[model samples]
Target: MRRHRHAKIVATVGPASSTPDQLRALFLAGVDTFRLNFSHGVQADHAKVHAAIRDLEKEVGRPIGILQDLQGPKIRIGTLQGGRLDLQAGETVRFVLEGADGDKQAIPLHHPEIFDAVVPGQELLIDDGRVRVRVTGPERTSITAEVITGGPISNRKGVNLPGTLLDLSPLTEKDRADLAFGLDLGVDWVALSFVQKPSDVIEARGIIGDRAGIMSKIEKPQALDRIDDIIRLSDAVMVARGDLGVEIPHEDVPARQKELIRACRLAVKPVVVATQMLDSMVNAPAPTRAEASDVATAIYDGADAVMLSAESATGRYPVEAVAMMDRIIRSVEGHKLYHSIIAASEPGEEETPPHAVATATADLAEAVRAAAIVAYTASGTTAARVARKRPAAAILALTPNVATSRRLSLLWGAHSVLTEDVDSYEEMTTKARHHAQDEGFAKPNDIIVVTAGIPFHSAGNTNNIRLMQI
Candidate 1:
């Protein structure tokens, strides 16, 4: 299916929208990518959803992307006395590394990395910042903190350390198991959560190895310190504002999101602005004005995609959420200021032949008022480079590899089609014209821009550009 908008939509699959029929409805409603959240379901559940997505893709005659989001290490307080405790502000609380059922004197924190990394004066947020405490004393086995913002905290409540840099790998035992399962299932993309360092992406890449695109979720504040390095190592990135907003100041999240999106665009990698966009749609039939603005803001900032988490997964109006997101993107992209804003924010081109050719292709396409920019990509790099320009023309990404086409689903303005490889220059023109008209991107008299490598099938060698009539 061809979408009118450039920015893609990623909708998560959950109990509310797992049925094959429901998935088909969602797809028709405008979901480009389907996310299978490993945090809430078993492998069997995900396998069923994956199968349904593949089935829907076949029925719709389009490439659909499946993203496997691995739940990383979860650090939380252990079991507590009577399963809960209430502490008042100005009271000192002790958190110990080893405890069965803790009382007000000492609360159980099973993760030792927290104790080892935390220092005095660093803030510790519990239960999504409902309860805040500052470290007054940090010892080998226990940490004493004074409650700054007091509230009732129950067992296994999450903890966020904004200042402490813990020596913990983002991938836990469960994440490793999930990763292996997802890879074996032939997922198109794998999203790594709680990425704090570039080494985490490197560690995951050692296993993925060109099988799927590795997306680093920028949720931890520490990640922002070395974000350039992490983005360089990753195939894509997600601006996860859920935990990121909790770790850093709420006022800084918007700026960080803009910066992250800009950085990814500059690096020519796909970036998704995720978490709580259109959150009200989870129960209501329509999104709030603020939520609509939030989604539109990402589009105006030139994000490759905007995502729906709970709004599409376990929400009362999953299909409606997708449809609403589609409407918002289309409206924002059609705005008069959209062209100038995106063009002004566009990153400078890299000094390389592939980049230079891709730039020229976009310039020529826009100058000629071409109906489409057809990119014959073996590894999808050519399309990605062209999409980095965010041209007004539609990107018709043609590839022989099904996996590459599937990965392109997350890219901006890309309408991927699985096609046979072209061996000669004449074959390229024929196929380009055929697909352009077949996909409704161009009419018989419409002009289109074609770009490919010189050797025809060689990957990442995008040095050729042509202007052809459809």
Candidate 2:
């Protein structure tokens, strides 16, 4: 089934929607991609879900993308006595870097890098910022801090360092193992978490090679410092706003999200705005008006896909969440200002061949009133560029690699299909014409524009554009 809207939906699968039937229902409900979060599930659990998604893909006769989000260096404070304790405000606490022994006065902080990385006056957030502490420098192998907003501190709650740039690898040992397993399972994308610099992306790319497209998760403030470089190296980027909200001021997320979307749009990389989008649907039957507006705003800002984390992963209304998000997108796209909103992006950037061709594709289609724009690519780059235009007609991306086709499924206005390799330019147009007609995107006398690089199968060589009649 074709989507009525341009933007895509990425639904995460978990215990709430792991069965093949449930996954297929989600697909029918307008989920374009399935994200298997490796943070909570075991390899065996993911293996089952991966197989199920693939099976559903075959049954639907459409390419579906699977993204394995790697859990980065997640720091947590060790347990307190009686498994919990109440620390009042203004209480001084000692956080040790080792041993799981501690009381209300002190606690075992498992991640030593936190002690080595943080300095005096930096804030540490625990339990998702419910408890806050201000550092007072280190004390031997521990760090002393005064609780700024103390409450009930529990065992093994997550910790967040707002501005501390830790000497931590984006791929932890567990992440490496999880990535290897997901790659072996043939996942379409791998999202690297807590990426601090371009080198982190380079390292993940070196290990990943071409096995899977690396999706860098932008959550840390440090990641914001090198977003351009990170976008340059990675295949895609996810604006992970949960931790990002903690790492930076809550009000700054909107501006930063817009900045990231614009940057990715300029580069023609797929960007997903994730974390708590439609989160209230986890238990409720419908989302609040504010949540509805939030989803609409992301689409209005041109995020390729808006993600549903807990809402789809473990929500009681998984299908409703997908359907709701789909409705919100379609409703926004139906607005008269949708196209104009997309047209308001920054326009002073230098143009490349691909950019020129993409801009020309949209203009050419309008000039000829063409049926669609067909892009033949190897890495889906050309199709993504074309999609960045938010063309008036559909964008068909034909690729020989199934993984490329699947990954392209998440792109706005991009309908990915696996096809035979095109060895010559003539074959490219002829095949595109036939597919366009066969796929019902065009009629016998319809005019359509075709774009692809010469020297077939070579990536980033989109120098050829043809306007053809089927």
Candidate 3:
């Protein structure tokens, strides 16, 4: 298949379209990737859907990416004492770690660490702000709250504290197990939800061990605060606007989305804009005009992908949603500024540690009319940097880590190849040239651009470049 100017499309699989026929139809409708949300289904269901996708790929003779999303740490209040409780606006309610075991007057707050981080007067929004509480006391297991808005409190309601930094870690035991499962399943990508720090990416990578690519979901405000570090550590990123909209001010989401997409583009990592693009299509056969504009805006902003959550996953018009997204992307891409935006948004040559050297190498590639640019990156940084320029020739990214390889597949105008470790710059260049030739990416007498560092596999150690003939 010919490469697309933008990155790709990731469609979630859900009840409305889980059958083999519907999956195949969606694929034909132009979904480049499929996301299996582990939060909703069991392993068996996912496995079946996976098998069907593989079957469809074989039938069509094209590779399709699969992303398995792990359900990260979800903090919420446990059951209410009485099936439901109504709190008045002026009432001071107590939220405790250990409350009445029965089901009537009290509600149980599960995460004690959250209690530690919350300070006086912090706003805690529950059920997407349908209910609001202002923290008032002691800041311990036993804390006092004044009901900002009265609503019925039920079992397992989600809690969001916008201003307070929760002491709890992003990943829980369940997330670790889910990561392992995704790895074992041989998924192309694993999306880490609620990622708040670089350490979370590192921990997930350690467990995944290169089996699958890691895409950090930027949903929480804390995650946005540390975005640069998280982007550097992760293979790719997902603009999960669902929880993100809930966690931050609604008016800020559009600006934040643009900022995130721009940052990822500059970093040369694939970024997917997700959630509510075609929300109206969840029940209706067609999307709202505003939603269409939203999808087009993401495309024009140079996002690597635009994702559909409930639209293609559980909507009544699953196929239609996929088709509409494909049409919208194509229409947006027709604009001349679309390509220019992508180029102008790329990071400058000065951004890389080995910028001067890599740029010199790239210039040599152009001067000699090289067949491709070969980038040997340990953390995939150099490869991404090369891709940002949108070179005339294909960019070949060779990585020892399979996760990085798969992740790069989503980047624009870049192809990824997994390889054994290379100990030296010379070995890396040689292997890269050989791989380019063997893979039919380059021919004899063709020049190839190669970029790498002296101490291979060291993060941020890139400092060497070369131009060689195949």
Candidate 4:
């Protein structure tokens, strides 16, 4: 099957549509990637979906990308004993770590991590900011708070700490287990949620052990602050605008999304714009014009992928949402400016070791009108950098790492091949050309760009470039 020219569409799977037949319909409807959210389902359910996707891939004779998103640390309040508590404006309430024992007025606060991070005068928003609490005590476990415009306090409502840097790692024990389970399933990508620093990506990758590509979710303000470092460290990124909108001002989400797309493009890492792209379609058959424009904007901004959350996963119109997203992407790609934006936003050569070589090779590819650019990367970093330029020729990313290969498959204009390590650039180029010709991707006389690091077996040292004639 031929690949789509524009950015790919990633449809999430949920209870509304998790069957094999539904997944096949989504694939046929132009979903290039499937996202499995570990936050909602059990391991067995995810396994079923994985097996179904593989079966469908075999049936369709094309590789499909699977992204497993680990639920990061989700902070929430403890159980409410009185069921629901209400407080008037400017009323003082104590948020204690202990359970509510027949307390009709106050609710218990769980998650001691929050207590450790919160200081006096810090704002705590519960239930998506429906209930606001201001820390007014010694900032200890027994912090005092005055409920500001409190509503019905349900059981275990989520807590959002805006502008407060909690001293907590993004990955929880649940996330660690989920990461392990995802690796066992052999997923192509593992998307870590609420990533704040590059260290989170490193830690997640260490646990994944090169078994899956790390896709960092840029949803928190802290993540935005360290975006460049995170981009350099991650294989892919997602503009997770849902919680981001909640954390930051909603008006700022659009600008942040654009900035994130540009950053990832410059890094040559695949970027996905996700959440509420077609939110209305969750219940309605058609999408609002605003939602349609949002999807188009991501495509025009040169994102490698656009995702559907509740719309395709738990929505009433799963198939229709996927079809609509496909239509929107195609329509946006038809514009002449789409290709121009992609080409113009291409990443320049990094001054770093292998980046310099990859840039030189990319320059030669453009000059020689090469049939393709071939990059040998164990970590998939070099290939990703080459792809950022949005070259006219396709990228044949050769990697011995299976996880890297599968992850690269979802990137724009990238075709991954699994092969053994080559001793030299010459051997790498020869094998690349052979593979290209064998796959009917190149002619014997065509030119090809080859790039690899010196002393090849060493990881993350891509420092060589060559122009070869097939």
- Best model number under lDDT: 1
What is the lDDT for 369 in model 3?
A: 82
CA lDDT, candidate 1, residue 300: 97
Total clashes in model 4, counting residue pairs 3 or more apart in sequence or in different chains: 2
lDDT of 2 by residue, 55-163 (tens): 9988989999999999988888887898897878998888887764778556989776787787789888999899998988676678888989979988888899987
lDDT string for model 1 (241-288, tens) is 999999999999999999999999889999999999999999999998
Which candidate leads the pack in TM-score?
1
Candidate lDDT scores, in order, read: 0.94, 0.89, 0.78, 0.81
Residue 461 of model 1, lDDT score: 98
Q: For every model shown, what is its TM-score relative to the native structure?
A: 0.98, 0.97, 0.80, 0.85
- Candidate 2 vs candidate 3: the TM-score winner is 2
By lDDT, highest first, what's the ranking?
1, 2, 4, 3
User: 444, model 3: CA deviation in Å?
Assistant: 18
Pick out the ten consecutive residues of candidate 2 with the lowest summed lDDT. 345-354
Off by over 4 Å in 4: 81-88, 101-104, 352-379, 396-401, 417-470
Task: Give a tens-digit lDDT track for model 3, residues 231-317.
Answer: 988878999998889888899999999999888866667888999999999999898899999999887777778898999888889
Select the stronger candidate by lDDT from 2 and 4: 2
Can you list the residue pairs that collide in candidate 2? none
Output the TM-score of candidate 4: 0.85
The true-versus-predicted C-alpha distance at residue 418 of model 3, in Å, is 9.9
